[model samples]
Target: MGSSCGPTGPEPGAAAERVIYLDNAATSWPKPPEVLAAVQHYLLEVGANPGRAGHFRAAEAGRLVFRARRAVADLLGLHNPMRVVFGANATWGLNQAIAGLLRDGDHAVTTTLEHNSVLRPLHRLQEEGRITLTVVRAAGDGYLDPDEVRRAVQPGRTALVAVTAASNVCGTIQPVAEIAARCRTLGVPLLVDAAQAAGAVDLDLARDGIDLLAFAGHKGLLGPTGTGGLVLADDFDAARLRPLTVGGTGSRSDSVRQPDFLPDVLESGTLNVAGLAGLAAGIDWLHGPGGGPEAVGRHELGLRRRFIDQATARVEGFQVAGNPAGPAVGVVSFTVEGLSPSDLGQGLAREFGVLGRQGLHCAPLAHETLGTFPVGTLRFGFGPFNTAGQVDLAVAALAEICRQERP
Candidate 1:
């Protein structure tokens, strides 16, 4: 557990040395070597526009894109790879799903523990008089009961139900499958944001009954930035989803009209072939022989347990945000009595080179639910690249920092 496949400190003679990196929830660092290599191969060897031409390099580029879609499909247990569509990131994917699914006066239900990506879009739609939004508050521990979701959806009136699979701030794993069943019963389509859950938790598209699933490639997927998308269910009609952007999809170019196909219907313009190449490698690494999500989860959970145990024991006024007994990923949020979250985070980085995130972690509603809003909790997010020694370094840094600051 000391060192694995993830990033470590900077090399000698490097001016700004990196120490312990615990901000993986924001974006995983030190992507697998395979991922970097795949990206490099795409840039150097497979240089061509995919699906835009019929040349050999273009075909290779298209194959790279196709392989990426299949990799993501395999990760989500989706049978049809064509149902997956690429975008800039999960924000793009979420926007497409939310904006495409709902219309004027249509009602949608969501949870309080949502990132701005979900909240902002719904709020914009609501403000525009496009859809009526209902926010189901989570329990004090950041847990949402499926019954609460069931109660929020207005049966036939609710057009869509959106929820994050895991809280970005506190790492609380929601009951998406249960909520999906409820959505099914209510005849409502369910859109799940797996930004925090993908590659950290298990997700089966068919088994979970998720109509639309959006996820980031860089987070738990361990891919490069600017790569993410959504996967539509097999029976889910692409015709219902209006294109967020319409342009040359490299298919059906004769009519100058948008193509009506699974990927082409949503994907327009040149695809991120290089980014997808790395993403595909990341997914393959996660599901392949060298590494898997199960192994990664176990490692990160061990680090989480170590940090929580050591921090609570060493720090006088330490407080954990969510219920530790509940299901979660490798995220932990806490606060100390005397030090502000910003101060602690900055001090950790400055003094010990221990990188962590502070504030609401881009999920204000989550912090509000955890009663840590306005002033948020310090967040430590462990990843596959992290080590047991790094966790110890973080704990020691926290203990020392708290001891020095406390009266």
Candidate 2:
């Protein structure tokens, strides 16, 4: 993790065919072998609908699904596992929370650091006159002050305060505990979009006073896509939150009405059992004694520091979005002179086989906040499996591109 690791970049002539992947922000790659095995086990060995039948396969599937729920709960430091609800992804969970909870005349407070998953839905609700939305602005450094968030709450009118745990574009970790405390003081429900923070940060849902938390299984959790969930607080009243979809939950069969419980209320129809199986394995690996969020975060942060330090030193006219000194969870966005983000990204891929994400990163407001609006920045997201060598290669690739394009 230190400079003693030496230059890990590729050799001068050995760059063309080697692949350097630094796009973990979108979705993690080279998933843990345990995740793949778990998915295969679910599909091949226990190919049965969970909670639908009394047979052995169905029972195994049901047990696996329940274990996945508990694994997510444990990962987030929630004692009651029933509060975890499966969804297609964090977007699905965010929609359920935004559309289900807020009603006409209700007010909700969010920030510019949100992804479209949060912004679009809130905008729609505001446009439809369902809820009055207030977007609190973060500081120029991309850091949101808790007091500023508190001032945006409308007391009796504010039904919910939604926010992202970290910025997806520039990787600024928000002051979640401070904001959660303010929300608790106002007796307003808090919903956290944890798509970037799940396995990259240590989140204590109960201790942090978060009412609801939404996270993606594919990113930090190292699970397959189409796997994610929302965790509700123990005291959270499900009656206030409505289901986006209602159908057979494999329970409450006698009545045609939707089940009035924790998970069954939110999860309806056939669940993504295979994906959930992989998610469970991912969480298990994350929660392993030697490997946890604390360890994973430290590893990613080291790599992030290495990349940022090298890039800033080597790339001329390099501009890093957001406060480079601020807290982050392994994501960095930067721009070089005389190159569009797309062009720079493409050049890295074509010339160096370095894969990175370019453009607004699905968070235009975040770029707007960073003053990189229309053009955006090249983003390199590090994962647990990413090494110092990979980070070095990316930096060298960018440095080379910057030199070639600028001169």
Candidate 3:
């Protein structure tokens, strides 16, 4: 599994002295060196917009962007790279898919485990009287039943079914394949938000029967922020979806009508080319020569297991939000009996240099589903860069934080 792209931990220093970044779910830090180098090269040597002009540099930039698109498509199990439409992030992609496809009188189905990225847009549409919405609730363990989703879908009435592949707050991996199977049989398109599952879970859009997928580059994909997109299945029709934004696509110069093409229709205006370059490097690093997602997933899981084992055994008042063990991703979230999440998170950051997420993590219903609303749990999103030593130090810090009384 050794490769130049493998995560390299912090340099030698006291455990408390170094910043133990545990908020990988927000955005990954200490990005792979290859990602940094690729970005620098793009900004310095190849400084031109893709598809904007016919110059040599522009053509090369376009080529670089296409390479990234291909990498993303392959990673997500798509046969055609052109189906990957770049966007600002998973939120943007979700809005495009949810808002664009659902028309008047259309009905949409979703789950409680989804982040606000999915909920907000769908709610907005519901409020506007454009679409009818059905949100299925998950169990306390954060698992959504595929049959529940099947029951929610109305044949020829449900336009789309949206669900999360993994919960950002609880790290539960939903039964997307089974859900997709039901949707396929009922003639409904399934859109999965893979923000937390892209690089951490085994997702094959074709095999899983997923119609559309939204992913974040910075979270599980280990790419730079401001990089992410929507991936369409080979058989899915891109024409059904409308553009979220439209501007200079550098195509169809004669007319102002938005070019109705695979990428040009959805991807308008200039893209973050430098960021895309870095994203390409990140994707290549994961699949080119290293052990890929399997190696990384195992590493993060080991770190999660280490933290849970140490924290629950050595510390008091440590209760995780969901089932401690399950078919899920690498995120672990817990609440302390004597301490509030904000208080504990502040103590970890100020006293021990351990940074983690607190509160509902922008997933209010997810916390409500877990019965942890109003007051949420402290979350530690394990990543490939995190080590067991760091987890040990974090556990020790948590013990100290719990020992102290409330203010």
Model 3, 205-226: lDDT tens digits are: 9999999999998887778999
**How close to the true structure is residue 166 of candidate 1, measured as C-alpha lDDT?**
88
Taking all chains together, each candidate's TM-score versus the true structure is 0.95, 0.95, 0.96
Error of 3 at 247 (Å): 1.6
Q: List the residue pairs that clash in candidate 1.
A: 6-385
- Candidate 3 Cα errors over 4 Å, as ranges: 1-17, 288-290
List clash counts for every candidate, in order: 1, 0, 0
Error of 2 at 155 (Å): 1.2
How much is 216 displaced in model 1, in angstroms?
0.3
**Off by more than 4 A, model 2:** 1-17
Answer with 2 or 3, whichever has the higher TM-score.
3
Question: Against the hidden true structure, what lDDT does model 2 obtain?
Answer: 0.87
* Candidate 3 lDDT score at position 20: 88
Per-residue alpha-carbon lDDT of candidate 2 for residues 284-351, written as tens digits (9 for 90 to 100): 77767216887777778788888888888888788889988778898989888778989899999999
lDDT for model 1, on a 0 to 1 scale?
0.87
